[model samples]
Target: MRHTLTLFVTLTVFWLLNSGHNTVLMTLLGLVSIIFVLYVAHKMDVVDHESQPVHLSLKFPGYFLWLLKELVLANISVVKSIWLGNSTISPCLMTIKSSQKTDLGIVIYANSITITPGTVSVDLIGDRITVHSLFKENIEFLKAGEMDRRVTELES
Candidate 1:
């Protein structure tokens, strides 16, 4: 029931933000659309009730701050590497163990790794993630397991 409500509210907000109109008719249409889509989704069984993990709403702010800091640091590292005279690029492929108990948590971890500049998650097999690193330094960062730890903390 909570997931259904969340889906409805999210779709309505997205429709309103993208529609760029403030008419009652359009608002009513958006609400109807949300309800219809969610109903169809529920019938299709695409949204598994068990897969949606309950999260601490208060932890999101801290997680966002941490992700922002990592993004900044990664940007700086990439820029420094570009400026460095030597071509220190050492491509490495490695498998990292994912500690996330839920599929959503694993998806978050993989997406976060891909979002960072130097690393890309090529494949996810069970609890193992295959990552390709642009440089040797990036490989070290992945091996440190900080990303997995942070994402798990957020998904809690």
Candidate 2:
């Protein structure tokens, strides 16, 4: 029930922010859209813990900020490598261990790796995520598991 209400409120706020119109007709239309989305989501049975993720709500903002910082640093590295030439981009594939206990945490960790420039989470099996990195240095950074540790923090 709490998750459902949270979803509804989040959807409404998202709609209002994106629409930018507060007229009665616009509000009604937005409400209708929110209801339809909520119905479909409920029918699909995707409103459970993994999907709703209320437990991680408070911690997500901090994680997001950290991700943003990592993303910027990665972008700089990629750009520098590009400027240095294609020879500087040494691609490699390797698997890194994930310590997260929950599916959501694992997914978040894998996605964080993917979202950061110069790395892609190719496959996740058991506690390992196979990653393709654009540079050898990126693989080394991933192997350090700082991002994995940060995401695991969100789970608990």
Candidate 3:
């Protein structure tokens, strides 16, 4: 029930912010659309913990800020490697251990690795993620476990 309400409120707010119209007709239409979406989502059975993720709501903002910073740093590193040419780049594939206990946390960690400019998560089997990286340092960074730790924290 809580997840359903959260989804509805989030959808309504998202609609209002994107639409940028407050007229009665527009509001009514938005409500109708949101209700339809909520109904469909409920019927699809995706409104539960993994999909809605209300449990992670409070911690996600901080994690997002950290991820944004990491993305910028990664972009810089990739650009620097490009400028330095092929000789400076070291391509490697490696497997990293993830400490996340939940599916959502594991997915988040793998997706995070993929999104960071220099790395791609190629596979996930159980607690291990196979990642490919343009630079050996990127793999070293993953081996250091900061991102994995943060994602594990998200699960808690």
Candidate 4:
């Protein structure tokens, strides 16, 4: 019930924000759209925690900020490597154990690694994730476990 309400409210807010119309017609249309979506979601039986993820609302902002900072640092590192030529690059494919217990947490961590400029999540097998990094430094950054800890916190 709570998840359903959360999903409804979230979808409605998104509709209003994205629609950018405050008139009666737009408001009514948005309300109808939200109701139709809720109806379909109810029929689909996906109005659950995995679908809505309301629990992640508060934690995700901080994680996003941290990830943005990491991306900037990674971008700088990549540019520096380019300027210094390919000699500075030491590409490696390695597997690391996932500290997250939930599939959502592991996915967020993997996507975060993949989007961070110099590293990509190649595969996830069981609790281990295979990562390909453009430099040894990027691998060391992942091995430090800071992003893993932050993502685990977001999920839990």
Q: Evaluated with lDDT, which candidate comes out highest?
A: 3
TM-scores, one per candidate? 0.84, 0.90, 0.93, 0.89
Q: Between 3 and 4, whose lDDT is larger?
A: 3
lDDT of each: 0.81, 0.91, 0.94, 0.90
Better of 1 and 3 by lDDT: 3
Estimate the lDDT of model 4.
0.90
Q: Of the pair 1 and 3, which is ahead by TM-score?
A: 3
> Which ten-residue region of model 3 has the weakest summed lDDT?
48-57
- Give Cα distance to truth, residue 30, candidate 1, Å: 2.0
Distance from true location, Cα of 27 in model 4, Å: 1.7
Q: 15-127, model 2: which lDDT tens digit per residue?
A: 98999998999999999999999999999998888877888889999999989998999999999998999888889999889999988889989999999999999999988
Model 1 scores a C-alpha lDDT of: 0.81
Q: Write the per-residue lDDT of candidate 3 for residues 6-108, one digit (tens) a residue.
A: 8999998899889999899999999999999999998999999888898888999999999999999999989998998999999999999999988999999
CA-RMSD of model 1: 2.4
lDDT of 2: 0.91
lDDT of 3 at 23: 97
Off by over 4 Å in 1: 48-56, 83-86
lDDT of 3: 0.94
**Model 1, 1-156: lDDT tens per residue?**
787766666678889899998899988888888888888989987655443333545686787788788888888877787788458667789998999987888888898888888889999999999999888888788888888898888877
Cα distance off (Å), candidate 3, residue 146: 1.4
